[model samples]
Target: MILTRRALIAGSAAATGLVYAPALLGQGKPRVVVIGGGAGGATVARYLAKDAAGALDVTLVEAEPAYATCFFSNLYLGGLRDFDSLVHGYDRLAAGNVTVINDLATAVDREARRVTLAGGQVLDYDRLVLSPGIDFVEDSVPGWSLAAAETMPHAYKGGAQTELLKRMIQAMPQGGVFAMVAPPNPYRCPPAPYERVCMIAHLLNQTNPTAKIIILDPKEKFSKQALFEEGWGKYYNDMIQWINPEFGGADVAVRPDSMEVVIEGEVQKVDCCNVIPAQVAGGIAAQAGLTDETGWAPVHPDSMKSRIDGNIWILGDSSAQGDMPKSAFSANSQAKVAAMAIRGELIGSRVFPAKYSNSCWSLIAPEDGVKLGASYEPSGDRIASVDSFISDTGEDAALRKLTYEESFGWYAGITADIFG
Candidate 1:
């Protein structure tokens, strides 16, 4: 199906449940089944497990034993941060009365309000919180499939592919070309591709000064454009090239064996390629009938309850949250709102006004970083940005250092909020 941005927005509004004006809070505990233990899901699990006490029964289902964050993945590639730093354990959630199930969820039955796992175990819940994050649409790019990913690592989700991409960079010969094909809009971490370029350039400048990096972006503008350009000009003037979609950089098809990308009928060969394909809600969400043609679930802004299934709440990158960018920070914030709404609903209470915020930081170098942040609130039918902040584009040695420091602090605080 051809997924347009407008269709996703309109579908979200229609699916949301009508507000019932809460009555006296009930006393019976409600069971919550949360899928995907990443940023948003982990945060919701932690909060519900911590505060629910005897009021809510929380279970978290994650396909992985541990989570590796994508926020500071560039630092890992640059050898600035160890993989251990980005790794988070789920013991805290378990301690807080959350049943942490490290297994794959095969299907979600909206009618039965149950989740079926690969092992044949079925989990029933009073409220379902889904934050499974994103999955690439393989058909979005011709010639790109699961097999092709072996040669061209997306590395957008920061797992094995991230390690593979790092090794590819290390193994490339000096003066080789490293090509990156960035995805279109509404993907996770809008500035991530640019951040990857900056980090890669930093590594090349140190070891292989003659090597060059190229970015083929599908969008005319990117997040933190001025800051990224300013840093590139100041540090790696002739080492990097950026081709916008209008100028023929939007290439989706990849010949993995040849390391070639077809852009507007022209094929270009490269030594190393990082292909980030277009994304949509994860398979579970889509399979559950929560998603429409646009590959995103619509939810009530105040409650985060799915429009298609009133008992289910969608959070993080899977939900069409109006103007909000799909970032870890935004997901974390939305989880809190969803948690509160769920708590109120299970106990016959009135839902209150919801407020959300997010901040995204991109490191240009080991010691240099830039950031963008915004605050959001629910409007008539969608969430609207109310305020925003961004770091200055120019490179100031001291300010850049401070930015990196702040980035570290944000990471620490967020992980703690989700797991501690």
Candidate 2:
């Protein structure tokens, strides 16, 4: 008897490590395979399926069954929100006719238009969407690596790491020191590290009031610097300190084993240390040969379609689409544009001009919140900021409280939009 690859994969699906049986390829409908199920991939998949109305076969392959959003995770760290609140499952998407595969995508063959999963199954697609998000750059911070994450947690991704950092903070001895080695620019979220510092300070104020917080930043100025500093002075009352490049923040190293931070030649021991290194597009994007010298996948500003390969689209933090900050709101906005473009190309749906907007809201204290945002449109090969706005320094307490409440509403709305 002769056996084909398809027959072999089907017959030995269990033995070959296929967690979910491979979907039938070459269906009458055009296939869309989306890898990564965060804000970008999830929103795109949902949009395509709902809009196509059975005209397209959409599959989402996410490594984790449940996704923990990094956007509002700082609130959890600050004891303002619970960990469970940040987590979302894929069941709703699966129920809506989107094939939700809980497995890791190991490889992609552009010529064959196939994606190979770690579970040994292959998915053939007419169109592919890559939104695998950010990964740490190796050696970006000397002596800090994935192996050392257990000791000096980055907590920048989501879920477990965020919880771990909170636990470390709660366990700190009285008046102990908490240190953070912030990352450089063009990161996942420009304001995340600073927000993390604010959240940690908020937590320590209640639990360990005497504890000191230190921020060793490589950049001279960070997102909403004045707002955060003002909040620290008003709320934290000098409990937090920021060390910039002029004071050895640029030249820094870490000894995870000893929980030590070395600024220039000076070494300091701390009760907890959070090391956020430089970042790049996720490994899968590079493995698929979609990324460029910038370590990010370049996409057309208007359509979010890959510039390297027309059949693929890149969204979220993984995409280099100029002017847009790498935030969940930005990813969600890009996904909508990509969904429209994909539908138009595959099934002749009407395509419209793409417009994008993003807002990043951060909480400094209990009811103290600040935000920065911008609108963008395609200009010359890049997305250019059309207009921008930010909360002013020394805003009245009522406005700040309103902003905090507005963020809560946004969190609920965006999560529903992504997961549903």
Candidate 3:
């Protein structure tokens, strides 16, 4: 059998004489395979490998050699942060005995308890944790597919497309229209599209005062509607425009090559367009047969264990946790609960109910930030919100600055929690 990337990493570790002890295999140690080393999977791997000590074998599979966080990506686009701030090193995870595999997962066989890599290698697992994150709903709009992403940068997942959008915005001529097509409900980062609009608008004001940005939102109300609208008014009053679902911004079709946004009955051609499509679980989760028609996997709330398979657990954007918005913070919070549950199960102990918390921050400007946060606990069959917080409308400058600082701190803490 061909060795997968993970097997190669493990083999390399063994070759380096990194304290390999096969004698420790049968001592209640359960092998756990994690798919997708993003916010959720990385955190789970770190915690499980560190806390479980020698009682758990942790392996992480990810196609990307390095991770670029979506959280502070807007700051990079806005020229407020550097690439170094958003990039993380996985040395801490390696130090915790977590084997990292840089490869794509092609298939997952639940019955055989094995994950197949694209290079035709199978990895068996005692417990499987999946946090592959979201995938675009290709058919959400006409003529919109992964190929379309090259021209009309979604920038939702914050990678190459993000830089593309920023470059396009910088090159746009004055008086040009920069259009943004927001996705429907239950998508990753509800405030993201709005935040992108704000950041782009900020740049436009400095370079091209006559340039306009139109937000075509499907939802009548957004995550932080009042605050975002207020920021737009205070910063760039006449330059920014928003059309809610009631006003024909709801239904949209895109032509990536032409850079046109069709809303209601009219097609509006623009210099730059961002179409953030509806999202579903990443491809690996769907291939594993863990997800249903809803594009998400149903899991036991307390344990994050898949309803379809006993030993498989799904986390982050792939798992359908009731009332949880698909945010990086939520993923980080869920990782802890899932790790604890897995630890409990491995020790033959009853897994207790889980609790989670999440806070999402949107930067409107260098000095302005808006946020919505909530804490929740498992209730009967769903996660119930216990308390919440939001940046108050019309706050003082000091408070706004405080919120901005808090947002930076959150980005640092969460990234550390995941990669460190």
Candidate 4:
């Protein structure tokens, strides 16, 4: 369980110190500059460092000192986990002999094989991994912008935005209205906005029972819709109302000053709103010429290498690989394959066929959880799901609690895998 960097040190040590041997034929170790030290980037960096021993010089560039995962932020909103519980540092990856840089990645010079940092540091690399997650499409929601995030919070990203949403939920007026505008398809955590609504309702039931939640969704159907509806009926009957696109859910605009949501030309007052808009690959990907017109980076289905630049790879939500939802698990899974392929091409490491899997778990109420999972492999031009599983809607409370417990274990295991 202790996956330390010293475990990768090859050959015997001398009496004075260790005499390490390189795995590659080069003046120095083959450099790998990973941008966005989240699930995908961090996991790849760690895997390369561990698997390659002293052959690869891995550097992870991340602005934040610690990453607060958006996956379980809903649990934090529901008071199931503390804020600190969702946050993870890079200490484990650093201990794995990876250079963990605490700075922003500004740009990627694909031709030069260099990445520029926010602090004017140019990092050259033999290979680059870009997994910077999502960035929103500006003006997708009328009158909603980054500045308006203070008033109408979009807690899609983790950290401060999540805390802001939590506070807004707690600050709701007695018997007030809480509204949520769900994002369009092909975004990070497909079922997350609905889960956040459930967590908000759970908090409201504990604090103010009369408060209502209105969900304006752009899509007609959502991930785990049947399961969420079942849980909502069982736990919070008549407390939540979901309106889909056919019912004017898609035609909506927000006015933060008046705290009004205009849906289908009908104006309604809401105490708070969680507005999640359409998203694309992170800025760094677009800047690096890795992304296409679809706003996501296109990659080879097998190894996740960029179609535009072979030396760079895309992972996680930023990657437009078919059949994979943009979740932390997907990113982590993709990272391993990319790491393996990169190592195989760079060094003399044995490579295997690419396989990927992901499971997204959502909490409907306290001790009530449901999950959807799939296993995928490379097809002609996409990663197609070969098998799938999901939690049943009619499962007993014991099973639901067990599912929730299983999610906790996954979080622990994945964080360890990525960080270490």
lDDT of 1 by residue, 138-242 (tens): 976677776788898898886788899998998889899998888888899898899889989988888888998988888889999999998899889689999
lDDT of each: 0.83, 0.90, 0.83, 0.88
TM-score of each: 0.91, 0.95, 0.93, 0.93
In model 2, the worst 10-residue window by lDDT is: 17-26
lDDT of 4 by residue, 213-236 (tens): 999998989999999999889888
RMSD of every candidate to native, in Å, equals 9.6, 2.7, 3.5, 6.3
lDDT ranking, high to low:
2, 4, 1, 3
Residue 30 C-alpha lDDT in model 3: 84
Best by lDDT: 2
The digit string of per-residue lDDT tens for model 2 on 61-164 reads: 89888999999998999999999999999877876778777778999999999999887778899999999999998698898998888889999898889889
The residue-by-residue lDDT of candidate 3 on 245-316, one tens digit each, is: 888887788888888988886988899988888899988888988899999998887778888999988988
**Predicted model with the maximum TM-score:** 2
State residue 374's C-alpha deviation in candidate 2, in Å: 0.9
